[model samples]
Target: DCKKAVSGKSFYAMEGKPVCPKCVGVDEEEEEEEEA
Candidate 1:
């Protein structure tokens, strides 16, 4: 996992859950993809 801060990069973008901007570019994970 990325250790970079994604505060202003994607603050409150997905409800109240804060996601890492570094990992945003990665789409190899099918975890949330299946649910979405």
Candidate 2:
């Protein structure tokens, strides 16, 4: 997992692996807005 700990926020299953919300999509969109 990309996160050190699961904070019980939420997650999505990626090929049977748990991935955090940010890792899935949130962070990338934010980063893109900042770049723009």
Candidate 3:
């Protein structure tokens, strides 16, 4: 999972949750492929 910094803490954006900017691209690609 991609780690995001929030108030100096680490965050992991899951598959369905609202993804952090660093993870958006990767998640989008996988999501679209899975739906197809």
- Over 4 Å off, model 1: 11-19, 26-36
- Give the Cα error of residue 20 in candidate 1, in Å: 2.0
Q: Rate the local accuracy (lDDT) of all candidates.
A: 0.47, 0.61, 0.47
Ordered list by TM-score, greatest first: 2, 1, 3
Model 2, 1-36: lDDT tens digits are: 575345765667777887777676654233435542
Q: Whose TM-score is higher: candidate 2's or candidate 3's?
A: 2
Q: Estimate each model's TM-score.
A: 0.24, 0.48, 0.21
lDDT of 2 at 22: 69
| Residue pairs with backbone atoms closer than 3 Å in model 1 (clashes) | none
lDDT of 1 by residue, 1-36 (tens): 344564445432344455564455544333455534
Model 3 lowest lDDT segment of ten: 27-36
Regions of candidate 2 where Cα sits further than 4 Å from its true position: 1-4, 26-36
Q: Candidate 1 overall Cα lDDT vs. reference?
A: 0.47
In candidate 1, position 14 carries an lDDT of 41
Residue 14 alpha-carbon offset, candidate 1, angstroms = 11
